[model samples]
Target: MHYVKAKGILSAKNGMNLYRGCSHGCIYCDSRSKCYHMEHEFEDIEIKENAIELLEIALKHKRKKCMIGTGAMTDPYIPLEMELGHIRKAMALVCEYGHGFTVITKSSRILRDIDLLKKINDTTKCVVQMTMTTYDEELCRKIEPNVSTTRERFEVLKELHGAGIPAVVWLSPILPFINDTEENILGILDYCARAEVYGVICFGMGLTLRDGNREYFYRQLDRSFPGMKEKYIRKYGDQYMIESPNSRKLMALFHEICRQNEMLHDNAQIFAYLNTFEEKYAGRQLSIFDL
Candidate 1:
C-alpha cells in the first residue's frame, strides 16, 4: 500500500472511497476496467492520506444531513483497513456531523465497527450492504477467493439486523454457465430472507465483461473452470454485458421469491431507499425547557 494526498474526498453525490484499488481478487471486478483509469496495480491499494480530514470538512459544511456512502469502487473493510482504521475514523466523522452512513462490503471485517454502525443508526440511519455472488461455499471461495465466504457474510447480515441496523445485499455479477442456475439464485435469496435484509439488488442474471476485467476473468476461468474461457469468447465476443441465456427465467424467479418474502427486489426502488436518509430520532430528545 502507498499513501497519497487527495485533492478532495467526497464526491458530488456524497460518496467517497478512502482507498483505491482492492486486494479481494474477485475475477469479475469491474473496477479493473480501463475506463476507471487507475495508475497502480489493482492489489497495491492507494490510501487517500487526507480522506478523513476532507470528509470532516465536507460534513461540517453541508447544510443537509443526507447519507454518506463508501465502498463503491473498493470495499472499506479490506484487510488493510484493520491496520489503517480510515473507515472507522470516517464513520466517526459522519456520526459527529449527524449524517447517515452506508457501506457496501463483502468482508466480515465490518463487524469490528458494529457499535458505531448501531450508534449512527440509532440517530439517523446506517445501512450495511454486502455482495453475495455464489451460494455454494466452495464455489464462492473459487470466485471470491480473498473475501468472506457467503455464510460469513450472511452471519454479518444477521448480526446487523439483530443490532437494529438495516442491511441490503447486492446479488450481482452472476456468471453465465457458472452460478447462474435457479438453485444458486434461490439459495442466495433464501439467505437474504433469513437475514431479514431490507432489499436485494440484482441487475438480472449475468455479469459484465470489459477490456481489463474480461482478460483477467478469462485467465482465471482457464485456470479454474477449464475450457470456460473458450465458451465465453465464443458466446460473448467483445460484448460488455454478458447476460445469461436463462436470464429471463432466473430474473422471474428472483422477483417472485423476493415478492413472496416481502423484500424489495426492484433495483431502482432499492437505490432510492439507499440514497434517502431518514432522521429516525428527530425531536426525540427532551428540551432544556422540559427539564
Candidate 2:
C-alpha cells in the first residue's frame, strides 16, 4: 500500500474513489484495462491521502443535498479499508452534511459500518450495492479468491435489510462457458429474493474482455480451468463484449424472476433510485410555530 496527495476528490457526478488499484484478485476486473492507465501494479493499492478532506469541502459547499457514491473503479471496502478507516470517515462526513450515500462493494467488511449506514439512511438515504457473479462457492473462490464469497455477501444483504438499510445486487460479468448456466443464475437470484434486495442490476449474461483484463483473464483461465483459454480464443477472438449463447433465454428468465419477486429489474429505474436523494424527516419535523 502507498499514499499520494490527490488533486481533487469528487467527480462531476459526486462520486469519489478514495483508493486506486485493488487487492481483491478478481480475474475479470475491468479496472485492469489499459484505458484506465494505472502507473502502479494492481495489487499495490494507492491511497488518496486527502480524499476525506476534499470530500468534506465538497459536501460543505454544495447548494443542494445529493447522493454521494463510491466504488465505481475501486471497491471502498477493500482489505486496506480496515486499517485506514477512510470509508467510515467518509460516511461520517456524508451523514454530518445531511447528504445521501451509496457504495458498491463485494466485501462483507462493509458490515463494520452498519451503524453509520443506518444513521445516514434514517436522515436521508443510504444504499449498499454488492456484486454477485458466481453462486457456486467453489467457483466463487476460483474467480474472486480474495474477497467474501457469494453466500457471505448474502448474509450481509440480509443483515442490511434487517437494519432497515436498502440493498442492491449487481448480477454481472457472467463468464461464458464457465458460470453461465441456469443453475448458477437461479441460485444467485434466489439469494437476492431471500435477502429482499431493493433491486438487481444485470446488464446481460456475459462478461467483457479487453486488452489488459483479457490477457489477465486468459492467464487465470489457463491456470484454473485449463483449455478454457483456447476455447474463448477460438470462440471470441479480439471481441470486446463476450455475450453468452444463452443470453436471450437467461435474460428472459432473469426478468421473469425479478418480476415475480416484485424487485426492480429495469436498469434505468434502478439507477434513478440510487441517484435520487430523499429526506425522510423533511416535512415530519415539528417546528417552533407548530409547537
Candidate 3:
C-alpha cells in the first residue's frame, strides 16, 4: 500500500472512496477496466491520506444532512482497512455530523464497525449494501477468493438485521455458463429472504466484461475452469454485456421471489432509498417550553 494526498474526498453526491485499487482478487471486477486509468497495479492499494480530514470538512459545511456513501469504486472494508481504520473514522465523522451512512461491500470485516453503524442508525440512517453472486461456497471461493464467502456474508446480513440496521443485497455480475443457473440464483435469493434484507439490486443475470477486465477474467477462467475461456470467446467475442443464456428465466424467478418476500427489487426505488436521508427526531426535538 502507498499513501498519496487527495485533492478532494467526497463526490458531488457525498460518496467517498478512502482507497484506490483493491486486493480482493475478484475475477470480474469492473474497476480493472482501463477507462478508470489507475497508474499502479490493482493490488497496490492507494490510500488517500487526507480523506478523513476532507470528509470532516465536507460534512461540517453541508447545509443539510444527507446520506454519505462509499464502496462505489472500491470496497471500504478491504483488509488494509483493519490497519488504517479510515472507514471507522469516516463513519465517526458521519455520525458526529448527523449524516446518514451507507456502504457497499463484500467483506465481513464490516462487522468490526457494527457499533458505529448502529450509533449512526440510532439517530439517522445506516444501510449496508452487500454483493452476493455465487451461492455455492466452493464456487464463491473460486471467484471471490480473497473475500468473505456467500455464507459468511449471509451471517453478516443477519447480524446487521439483528442490530436493527437495514441491509441491501447486490445480486449482480453473475458469470454466464458458470454461475448463471436456477439453483445459484435461488440459493442467493433465499439467503436474502432469510436475512430479511431491505432490497435486492439485480441489474440482470449476467456480468460485463471490457478490454482490461475481460482479459483478466478470461485469464482467471482459463486458470480455474480450463476451456471456459474458449467457450466465452466463441460465443461472446468482445461483447461488453455478457448476458446469460438463462437471463430471461432466471430474472423472472428473481422478480417473483423478491415480490413474494416483499423486498424492494426495483433498482431506482432502492437507489432512491439509499440516497434519501432521514433523522429519527426530525420534528421531535425537545424545546425549552417543554422543560
Candidate 4:
C-alpha cells in the first residue's frame, strides 16, 4: 500500500472512494480494465492521505443531507481498512454530521463498524449492499477467493437486518457455463429471502469482459479451469457482454422469486432507495453543560 494526497473526496453525487486498487483477487474484477487507467498494479492499493479531512470539509459545507456512499470503485472494507481505519473515521464523520450512509461491499469486515452504521440508521438511513454471485461455497471461493464467502456474507446480511439496517444484494457477473445455473440463482435468492434484504439488484444472468479484464480472466481460467478460455474465445470472441445461454430462463426465475418474496428487483428502484436520504428526526444539539 502507498499513500497519496487527494485534492477532494466526494463525487458530484456524494460518493467517495478512500482507496484505489484492491487486493481481493477476484478473477473477473472490472476495475482492472485498462479503461480505468490505473498506473500501479491492481494489488498495490493506493491510499488517499487526506480523504477524511476532505470528507469533513465537504460534509460541513453541504446544504442538504443525503446518502454518502462508498465502496463503488473499491470496497471500503478491504483488509487494509483494518489497519488504516479510514472507513471507520469517514462513517463517524457522516454520523456526526447527521448524514445518511450506504456502502457496497463483499467483505464481512464491515461488521466491525456495525455500531456506527446502526447509529447513523437510527437517525437517518444506512444501507448495506453486498454482492452474492455464486451461492455454492466452493464455486464462490474459486471466483472470489480473497473475500468473504457467500454464506459469510449472508450471515452479515442477517446481522444487518437484526440491527434494523436494511441490506441489498447484488447478484451479478454470473459466469456463463460456470455458475449460471438454476440451482445457483435459486440458492442466492433463498439467502436474500432468508436475510430479509430490502432488494436484489441483478442485471440479468451474465458477466462483462473487456480488453484488460477479459485477458486476466482468461489467464485465471487457464490456471484454474483449463480449456475454459478456449471455449470463451470460440463463443464470445471479444464481445463485451458475455451473457449466459440460460439467461432467459434464469431471469424468469429471478423475477418470479423476487415477486413472491416482495423484494425490490428493479435496478432503478433500488438505486433510488440507495441514493435517497430520509432524515427521521431532529439531531440532538450539544449543550455547553454536556460538553
lDDT of 3 by residue, 1-291 (tens): 999999999888888899999999999999999999999999999999998989999998999989999999999999999999999999999999999999999999999999999999988999999999999999998999999999999999999999999999999889989999999999999999999999999999999998799989989999899999999989989899999999999999999999999999999999999999987764343356655
State the local distance difference test value for candidate 4.
0.93
Model 3 CA deviation exceeding 4 Å by range: 282-291
Q: Compared with the true structure, what per-residue lDDT tens digits does model 4 show for residues 116-189?
A: 99999988999999999899999888888999999999999999999999999999888989999999999999
Model 4, runs deviating above 4 Å:
282-291
Per-prediction TM-score, please?
0.96, 0.97, 0.96, 0.96
Candidate 2, 1-291: lDDT as tens digits: 889999999999999999999999999999999999998999999999999999999999999999999999999999889999999999999999999999999999999999999999988899999999999999999999999999999999999999999999999889999999999989999999999999999999999988899999999999899999999999999999999999999999999999999999999999999999887665343356655
Tell me which residue pairs clash in candidate 2.
none
| Total backbone collisions for each predicted model | 0, 0, 0, 0
User: How well does candidate 2 score on lDDT at residue 36?
Assistant: 93
Pairs that clash in candidate 3: none
Put the candidates in lDDT order, highest first. Answer: 2, 3, 4, 1
Which ten contiguous residues of candidate 3 have the minimum total lDDT? 282-291
Error of 3 at 276 (Å): 0.4
lDDT of each: 0.93, 0.95, 0.94, 0.93
lDDT of 4 at 284: 47
